[model samples]
Structures are given as C-alpha cells and as structure tokens.
Target chain A: MAEAAGYDPLGAAGTWRHQRAKLVVYTLLCLFALYYVLPLGVVILNSFRDLPDINRNGLIGLPHSFSLNYWSLAWDKFCVGGTCAGIEPFFFNSVSMVVPATIISTAVGAVNGYVLAKWRFTGSEVLFGLMTLGVFMPGQMVLLPWARVLGWLGLTNTTSGLVLIHCVQGLSFTTLFCRNYYVNIPDDLIKAARIDGAGFWRIFRKIVLPLSPPILIVTVIWQFTNIWNEFLFAVIFSSGTHQPITAALIALSAGGTSVHQYNVESAAVLIAALPPLLVYVFGGRYFLRGLTQGALK
Target chain B: MAVEPVTLTSVKAAPNHGRMLRERLATILPQLVLAPSLFATLIYVFVFCGWTIWISLSNSSLLPDYSISGFHHYVELWSNRRWTIAYTNLFLFTSLYVIGATAIGLLLAILIDQRVRAEALWRTIYLYPLAVSFVVTGTVWRWLLSPSTGVERVVHQLGWASFKFDWLVQREMAIYTVVITGIWQASGFVMALFLAGLRSIDPDLVKAAQIDGASMPRIYRRIILPAIGPIFISVLVVLLQFAIKTFDLVIALTGGGPGIATTVPAIYVYDLMFQRGQMAEGAAAAIMILLALSLVLVPYTIWKNWRERREAARG
Candidate 1:
C-alpha cells in the first residue's frame, strides 16, 4: 500500500528520487540551523560597530570599520553610580559568588545525590521529589521571600547571601541529575568493597566518587554557568558591589546614557555573554548531557 | 562536613546492637544528608506560602496587619484593568511560548539526532542562551526589537520600507513579540531534552520504518512521537512553568508597557509589591498565580508519579 504508487508513478529512478529527497532534507535542516544561528551572528556583528555606524550600517550589516572603542567605553568611564566603573566589578562579583556557590552546591549535591541513589530509606523518593518541585518554581516568584529571609539573616546585599541562594537553588536539579546518573552504576562495586571490609564512607569516597568524574565535571560546569547567570536573586538580595554580571547587564541596558548607545550596549551585551559562550564552546557535550538529565529528567 | 560513618548512635546506646545499628545508620544517613533541603522546602513552600496565603486574607500593607480583609483584594484584582490584561497576556504568552519552543526545539533535536556533522558546534550555538540569565538575553532581544534605535529602524533602511515589525510597540502584538523572544532564549533547552529522548529511541524502529517505505516525517509523527510522548509531556510541563512564571523578559524587554499589553501575573504581582506599594494586593495576586500553577503542576506531578510507580512496579 505504501510503496505501489511511488515505484513508477513519476517514472523516475528510485535512487534518483532518494538522492533528491536527501538533498531536500539536508537543505531544510541547514536552513533551520541558520534560523537558530543568524540572530547570534547579528549580535556579534552589531557589537563591533560604533553608535553612528550602527545608525548608518544597520544591525544586519557588517561593520565597515571594526573598533574596540565600545568595549573599552563599556568597561571604563562608564559612570555606574557616582563613580567610574565598568562591568569589571560586576564580573569580579559574579566570579567570586558563583565560584564558591558552584563548588559548595556541587559538593553537597554530590553527597546528597550519592545518598539518594545508593541508599534505600524511608521517604527518600519524597525528598528527591520535593527537590525536583523546587527546581520547577521560577526564581522570580520566590525571589521576594528569599530576599526577606536573607534580610533577616543580615546577608541581604552581600556576596554571602547570593552564593548561598545559588547553592540552595542548585541543590534540587543538580542532586536530581547526579542521583539518576548514579542509580545506573552497578551495585556489585559497592558489594565487592563491603566484602573487602571497606566502610560505607570509604567505599563511596574511594570507589564511586572517583568513577563519576565525568558527571561531576559536568555538574560543576553546569552549576558554574547557573550561578554566573543568575539574576532575580542577584537583583533582589544584592547591591551594586555584590551584583552578578547579569544584574550589571540589566542595570547598564536599562539606564541608557547619551542617545541609547546600542553598539556599546550590544558590545556590553556580548561581553556579558562571553563566559557562557566560552563555557559552552569548551564543555558543550557536558552541558547538553547535564541539561537533558537535570531538571528535565 | 566529614563523610565519616556514624556508629548508629541511637542504636549503639543499646548493648550488642551491631545489626540494628547498621539498619538505623542506613535509614538515618539519607535523611541527614537530605535534612537541609527538606527543611528549606518546608519553610519556603509550606511556611512562606502559608504566610502569603494568610496575608492575602488580612489587611497586610507594606507592613504586616492582623486585621481581616476578607476577599477584598481578590475582588479588587478581578476589577483591575492591568491585572486582567496581565492574566490574558499570561495565557497567550504561555500558549505561544510552549508551542513555539517545542516545535522548533523538536526540529533541531531531530536534525541533530540524524547524524549532523559538527553536532557539538551546532548544539552549543543552540544551548548557549541557557547559560545567560533571562535578563541579559531579554535585554539583547529588547534592543533587537525596539522600534527606535534597534533592528526595526535599521530594517527600514535596508529598502524594505514597509517592514512593520513593530509588535513591541503595539498593544495586541507586544505579548506575541515577548513570546517569540521567550522561545528564542528557551527552545535550545527544549531541543536538548528532545535530542536526549531521541537518542534513547531504538535504531531498529527507524530501520524497520524505513524498510517499510515510511518517510522521515511519517516515521517521526507516528513512531517517534509516541515513543517520545513522555518526554514531550515533561518538556511541555517545564515550558508551561516557565511561560507562566515569566517576568525578566517582560520586565527587561518591555517593562509590561505599551499600556500593560505584555504584563503577566508575575509582572502584575511585581508591580503591586515594588512599583505600586500595594503589598496585600500583591500577595493576593501572587497566591492566585501560585494556586493556578499548583492546580496544573501539582495534580500532573501526582498523576505522573503514580503512573511511574506503577510502571516501576511492573518492571
């Protein structure tokens, strides 16, 4: 029924038709790829132009003359608040907070995840489920209450609070991924360790921990990216000195100076995007795996 | 923080309690490791949420008040023009974003799954947005879409003079524009999930379908779709949660402006608390939004978990 009409209805060779179909599909897929990609290209190109050049050349146009002037301007001589500070401070703040947060979150996450996957206990699934639920709740809706909590702790507008929030938030999804991933590990390794008289802690520390390096690396990269780009909590709980790169980007964009410097803003935007872009370039495989298995799982 | 094994202290208090202690330690370790996270959830969801619910009933202003307000704020919310627009816009935004992201994301996933060369590069290009906060990406989109001083004005100069892509400015089209940007920032995530699901699909099925003269689209629609149905549901749930709780894109992009055209429940609640200083109304609106999400998410989660338990039992 499926094949009778296609064999000779058009009187074309089967090979010819199949080749044509392949070519068409390939073209369509490439076009779809372009649709996903061209906007980013436009952004990259637009970032290099000056304000006047942007008006003259348009966003889609290639820059007639590439200049590092906007990048410089965005970094220095940009009065953020009564002082000349560029995104440098924001970059520093993001690194300081995100680094500690990423490390702490992933570390605790590893243990929590290890326990969940390895241990069979009462209400374990319930604990994991609740963590998963927290992951689904968007940070904006929860930002206020968190900020209030932080304020009471005297951590509001501080680096400590932002880092803690990131660690806490990173717990749910990270633990979920690590747990699911660890579940697939064979049980015989633990059993063998027990036979060797290895303590539970030693078995986990010496055997399972070292073996799961790929996933741990993946977890670290993903959480670093997560903490780096976090905004709502950054905005709510931190101030200028403690803000992440994202909050800085927002502050810069919203507070336009001198006829909406789109090129500089674009440059700043591109600058803000660098860490993530670089992370993806280096660890794209791990990022994909982590995303697939994390909250989505 | 040390991972030292405990002697099952509770059971160790009894003599010759070795076997019982092992059992007790096994039970206690998971809960201890899980304690902080569990306590956080209970406090955040149960306690603060309870407080939010309580305040919605009381005359809580910027400061707390114990006096009862009844259904006053809810009635006011029903009457507020901006809140109504916000609710409608939220519905539209969520619908468009969930649909658009899933569609494009699936296409990307399928293409990548089908032995695309330099898959890592392409996947990276798609998923890079997930690394940036929505605010940063939202700012990027805002600039791209702004009527003046953005790509809109530039497109006019490119000799296509009638390119009226001013959806960001108009009331009716503003929400749609936000949806487009939302999809742009998020579909990569959706694509990754779909790709993972696609990879787990048995190659034999594709081979068999091809042997049967089933075209790619037909095979995908019939075979792949059903196989990936659970994944589809999961992705949609994530997308729905995102679309409903959307705030940064609207705030960073439009500020719920052009006459409240792009406001969602999130932004509506934000304005009530921060901009308008109407804390009770804001809390009420937030509770309403939470209730709406819980209505869909809580029940669906329960059903999915139930089905999952049954399936696991079968296995």
Candidate 2:
C-alpha cells in the first residue's frame, strides 16, 4: 500500500525504533477499527440471538443461542404501531420511492449538467449559481412550503409525494456532481460533434452520454442512499402503511410496550440499513469520490 | 477542406425550410432540456426559502395565513424556553461534534497515511458508518448506550456490578451521548476527506523536511498539516452543516430526551410545525436554523470563491 510518492523514507527497513512505532500505529488503527465495527457487529449478532439469550447475556455479548426466526418475523409478522404487517410494506415503500427518485434525478441532472457545462448561454452562470444554492438549503426551510405545495397538488401523505420531494431536493446535488464531471470533458469534443451537423440531443446521446457512467453511478448511489435513509421528510410527509422504512423503523422501535423485542428490532434495523450498506460495499470507490467531490466543491 | 465540403453537402442536401426549423430547434434545445430542472430548482431554492421566510414573519398558526405580520413569531421563538434550550443545545452540539470529529478524523488519517498494511480494509471499516443512515446509526447507538441492555449491563455481568453508563437516561448528560454517536458516525468521513488531502500533498516537501533532520511530529506540524489547511476548512464547513442538520441522529438516539434535554432546533421545528400546530413559530425556528447555516456557509463560499479567483489570477 506504500506508494513511493507519499511513503516516509524515515521509517526505513530493519530498525527497532521504526518497528516499535509501526506496532503502535497498527495497534491504534485496530483499536479505532474495533470501535467503528463494534456497533455493527453487535447488531448482527443480536439479530440472530434469541431474545432470552440477549436478555441473559446483555446486548454487547456473544450470543449463546441463535435462530433465524427473528429475521422472518421482523420481515412479516412483528407489529409496528399496532399494524402486524411488519417492515415489508415500509421496505417496499422505500424501494418504490428510491428507485424512481434516483433515476429521474440522475437523468435530469445529466442534461442540466451538459447544458450548463457545454452550452453556456447568457446568464447561465448566474442561473447555475442560483441552482447550486439548493445544495446548501436546509430541509427544514422547505418543509412548510412543501406541505402547502403538496397539499395544493393533492399529494399529501403518499409515497408519490415523497418521491417528488426527493427528486426536486436531489436535483442540486446531482447537477453539481454531473456538471463538475462534464466540465472535464473537453469542449472541443462537443464543438467537433456540432460541426459535424450533430444536433444537441445527438451530441448528448453519442458523445456526452458515453462519458456519463462514472458520475451517474456516483449520483445514483448518493441519491439512493440519501433518499432511502431520509427520516425527517419520510416521518412528516407519509405515515402508517405509506411510511418509508426509516420512519417505520422509528415507529417499530418506539411502539411496543412490555419487554423490548431486541431480536426483531435488531433484524429490522439491519433490513432498513441493508440496501445502502450493500451499495457502499460494492461501489465504495465511487461512493468516496462522490463524497469528496460533493463536500470539497 | 474535406470537412468543409462534407458540411456544405449536408447543408445543401437538407430542404431549406426543414433545415431552418431544425436549426431553430437545435438553438433552443439546451434551454428546453434545462427548463424543467431550472424551474424546479428556482422553486426549491428561491420560492421555498421566500415562502418560509414570509411565514415566519406572518401570524400563521395551525395553518398558513397570508396576512402580513411583524417579527412576532420570531420574538415568541426567541423568548420561549424550549427554543432557547434547543438553540443552546445546537451551539453546544455543533462545537463539540465538529471539534471531536475533525480531531479524531485527522488523527486517523495521519496514522493511516504512514503506509499502513491493508489500507483499503481499514478505510472500509472506518467509513462504512457513513453509508448507513443517521437513523440506523442513532438506533444502534441507543441500544448500545442504554444502561439496562447495553454497555453498563455488559460490564456489570463482567463482574463490575457498580458500573454506570446511563447517559442515555440522564437529562444533563443525554446530549453528550448524541455527541458521542455523532462523532462515531462522522469522524470516519472526516478521516476519508483528510486522507485524500494528505495523499495529494507534494512528496518532496516531506523528503526535504526529513533530510533536514526534522522529526516526524515536527514535520507534520510545520509542513504537512499546513499544506492540507484548505481541507481542514472544508471539513469544518461540512461538519458544521452536519451538526446543524442533526435531526435524525438525535431523534433516533435520544428523541431529544431525558425530558427535552436533547431537543435540537430541527426537533423543535418539527414539534411546533406538526405536533403542536404552531406553524408560524415553527417557521421562525426553521428560519433560525437556516440563518445559522447561512452564517457559516455564505462567508465560507465567498472566501472560497475569492481564493480561487486569486489563484487563477496568480497563475
């Protein structure tokens, strides 16, 4: 992992002092890693443990008894806020909301990026600046207006309404990602395509679209994870069967009386977290790229 | 010459009227393509912000009323005890969270940059928390921090019967649990950002410092950290925003609780707007949150732009 560029030559081969320093470094790294992974490991372990075992052993211990029963129970049988339909419907609500929001926002953002980057019109820079302001606008600032707007549009308390919110809310981020990327694609390419009598759509389809996959992946992962995990909007805009997994997870964990169902709740939490976690594991490079670019820019 | 003839032939082959229409369409195509997003963004940014600002200044309650009012809601929001607690909590959370996360992140980044083995594996472990939602992070931490079922119980079972890790239930200390969880979820992100910044620093500077017999710590303090100063600012800004928008994390973790001890501006906004039907004050609280964000963001943006312009001019 040591590249010549940034590698410290001071920590050269075969010195006890250097070796001791290395040991300290590794130890610290491992300790921090344990702190980072402990919660996830505990959750996974408790999800399969029997409730009695969890109760006896406490949440932080290794399981004494294991069963797959709670996974299915959390999926289909456990009641959340008096509804025994489990997390299945809310999971579907998230999926249905996330997929379209991701796709639509990415598609629109690509075109917006292409136009802003390649087809500079008068005042387009100012327009781009104004649009990017949406990136920093707090979600709280928009809730009242959105409530009124959704009411006006007859979209209150529906998954479709959440989908609309995500799309519009995600536009600035998606546009920023794609536009920064598209800026790197030489203008000469677009000009050449144009001189060949390729119209705007044709150039976009043939030239720009081919270069879009990297940014598109980043944008999609970003949008998917963000929209899926969004709680404030999900909690406020939809409820009951219409609620997304995040809000439902809150209700599920907060709802029951008597002894807390640690097993099922752990399983449900993992289920809610699974999609984005899978995306991160598979697309980590793009995910980090999106994060860095999104933050630094 | 070859390209010129091809273009001329294409122009000649197309019917004049059809070609003009196509030309017209092509001229407008980019704008047409951009129209919807532009319209949506304009509404999302300008219109929504304006509407909220207006509502905050109005007498709206239970529902929005369009009649103009003064800063009555803002006055009410400032004078309220819960709002005061929430705002103070926000200030405390932002400072501690930002400092704690950035310091830990920078430390981790420096450690990893020492050419560690299995760097990718370590990075993945550290950063995976960021992939999960704040809700998930908060919920999991809540379980782990709760005294009855979590760390305290586990420690007690290990034979320390007098152990007490019950910050989740203690009103004055409940906010610190949120801080701890916030640091856990976000510090790794700061590490990733700092790691990238560290990797981009010129190697020759480090080599020269080493040749001058400067120790590693001295080299880092005097040379490497200064080189990545811009990243520190970026990290600060991002973490500040995260701190300000800390809704779901606190909601899932403590529910702003141990009796309103952890109530943040976002939670307060939600309560007023939705639960209590105080829309105008809610809007005002929301605007306060917005104001706090803009106060941080606006100057940073202008400074960033000015710095970029200066760099370009220098180049």
- Counting clashing residue pairs in each candidate, in order, gives 0, 0
DockQ for each model: 0.33, 0.71
Which prediction has the highest DockQ against the true structure?
Answer: 2
Q: State in Å the error of residue B80, model 2.
A: 0.5
* Candidate No. with top lDDT: 2
Indicate the residue-level lDDT of B48 in model 2: 92
Off by over 4 Å in 2: A1-5, A9-14, B1-19
Cα displacement (Å) at residue B162, model 2: 1.2
The CAPRI quality class of candidate 2 comes to medium
Q: Estimate the overall C-alpha local distance difference test score of candidate 2.
A: 0.90
